[model samples]
Target: MSTAAPKTPKLPVTVDKPTPYNFDLGLLLANDPNPVSVPRTTTASSDPSILESHLANVARDGAQVLINQLLTTCAITSTSSGVLLSLPHAQTPLPREKPVPAPKPETKWSAFAKRRGIKPKTREQRRNLQYDEATGEFGRKWGYQGANKAGQDDAIIEVKFNSKKEAERKEGTTVRGDKRREIREKVKRNERRMRKNQRHSEGRK
Candidate 1:
């Protein structure tokens, strides 16, 4: 007995309801107005080949709808390669299949700021600039040849002591190198804090 070969399934060019898509929101984005993935579960079968064919048909239908939508709404451009369609911003907001991730924990500085109600300062403010009384000009507070390190430029620095204990310890001597040491220590502390925050964040992840 001779058996006839099964013919390949013909992909339908016209979809019944036409899968909704927006060319504006960029590529690979086809938004279904009324998602029926739940209803589709009712037709589930044990046959892998049948399931695969159904999926392929559904995908092909969706693609055709998307292509149709693109051709109608988008601005068409022709090139040596082929045709190009410029998609616009998508209006539809779609939710992800998975749950949204939790917010990252704040760093120590940010937490402290929030607790103290401390506002962020701009770079162009008083902290970033210093008024040079000698030249009567506003100069950078920190950086190369900045006002912060003006003590280093002078041959003899006049040191000021806040406490009686500090005065007794220094004995009214010039301490030009002390400022540099303090800055180095401050920078080291900040680096250590950043490293600790990084480790904490990785641990949470």
Candidate 2:
């Protein structure tokens, strides 16, 4: 018996008409005020091809809407128009500004006067006097009146005023032997008064 040649089955032609993109950006933008609120979930059985196509459609629709708005607002006639438009992929919120530090409280002479119970004298008023207004003490201001040693060689110069003899030896050009003794005595008196004042302030505190 003669057998007919086996016929091959012809494959079904799938004429895929381009899938129409039906996404509307205005509908989504109007319904959802916050883009962050949009759901980004996908079903377990969802086809990747369909999902990809849908996302592409959504992007195209959103881009078209943005282009239309920009063109209308900017009055751009063509791509060659002077307006150069750009859009950022994502926007980051600005960081909260650091709280401005409170201004430091000013130190005023009134506060000093209140603490010492006396009106504070200006530097010019107390220039030539050894006076403590709080203690009502007056004495001679003792110190060497030598020329400033800025121009002298500092390595060779020695300044010592621990005693009358040392003061006379160090700055003999400014103070003589008797003057050096007076200065030494004045310094000791000032130191004793300073210690007493410090103790009184501590007690007050």
Candidate 3:
């Protein structure tokens, strides 16, 4: 048996037509069946006075539009009675008041507490604390008045200072330095993994 190759079909070609163009001067001179001459009367638009009046009206309208925009921008309004009212009054500048000094304990025991470097447990607790000017004292409004004591409630807290050896012993008994270092290393590894993942995601984008 003989093997034969199939023939490929030819594609049709496309041809573009040339554009037509024509010009005539006679079209410009052709007169209309009902021709109207340019106005010459005083009241006509072509009249110098009338033209000037139209221009003035346009200028006035433009000025009124600009004025309205200006009024709107300034937060102002004009009523039907011509009385101007501010839509939203301009904000008044805040007064530059004197700076109030921070509250400090005045009494002897409270002063000792201050010397011992006692600090508030929380920001809210510090603010809510009341000061007695007459007796030179401070008081707490609510909760364990024990810590800040005399400042708000005259309740006092006893805090003991630990020696360096005592602190080290306590740290060893609870959270050891080696354990803390291990935790820190683990956290750093997790952070590195997250950074690597983030970089991969960014590269994909």
Candidate 4:
């Protein structure tokens, strides 16, 4: 009767240490590089398969290493992946400079007329007649005699023959109508001679 109900068994109370919990949480946050996910199997059924799968990764790692080494040698930070690893692009070799154009030659006729203080047309007229070399005087051709204008002074201008035409004339070639007929006659004569020679040779054989 006076005895109190058996003292209820004391339940153990656990007081978690705040310092340890905080320390553990801080350690986890400090060590984590990225959010954790469920770990996946890295090993493959075959060694070759595993190696092949990682080959590209290995190559990328090697490239990164090479880039880092180069950057370190140059005393630069290798943090940025976008930075060029080698020499910066040279100003695309300024398109090979185009050669400058050469100056044009001065016209001889214009220059001569200017020097002589005469108009171009007058100089041209002076050059048309055959001028005497020693006297520097000119005379009209036989067919053109008495045909010059009244104020023209009957002065003969020196005419320079075209080199090609002069050469043709020297070769005894005629350029106009009657000369062409003469050439045709000469060709006919040569053909006749050749036919006669052939006939004579055939008769002898």
lDDT of 4 by residue, 29-60 (tens): 11112232332455553356665656554444
What ranking of all candidate models by lDDT puts the best one first? 1, 2, 3, 4
Top TM-score hit: 1
Q: Looking at candidate 1, what is the lDDT of residue 64? A: 86
List the lowest-lDDT window of 10 residues for candidate 2: 28-37
User: Residue-wise lDDT of candidate 2 within 120-192, one digit each (tens)?
Assistant: 6798776655665655875444334332212233444454658665555554353234445565777899887
RMSD of each: 13.0, 20.6, 32.5, 31.4
TM-score of 4: 0.19
lDDT of each: 0.71, 0.48, 0.48, 0.45
- Candidates sorted by TM-score, best first: 1, 2, 4, 3
* Candidate 3 per-residue lDDT over residues 64-182, each given as its tens digit: 44444444454445678886534333344346687667664254444556799986468765576677676578655434652322233224533347755446664334322444455
What clash pairs does model 3 have?
138-150, 138-151, 138-152, 139-151, 139-152, 139-153, 140-152, 140-153, 149-155, 150-154
Better model by TM-score: candidate 1 vs candidate 3:
1
* Index of the highest-lDDT prediction: 1
Number of clashing pairs per prediction, in order: 3, 0, 10, 3
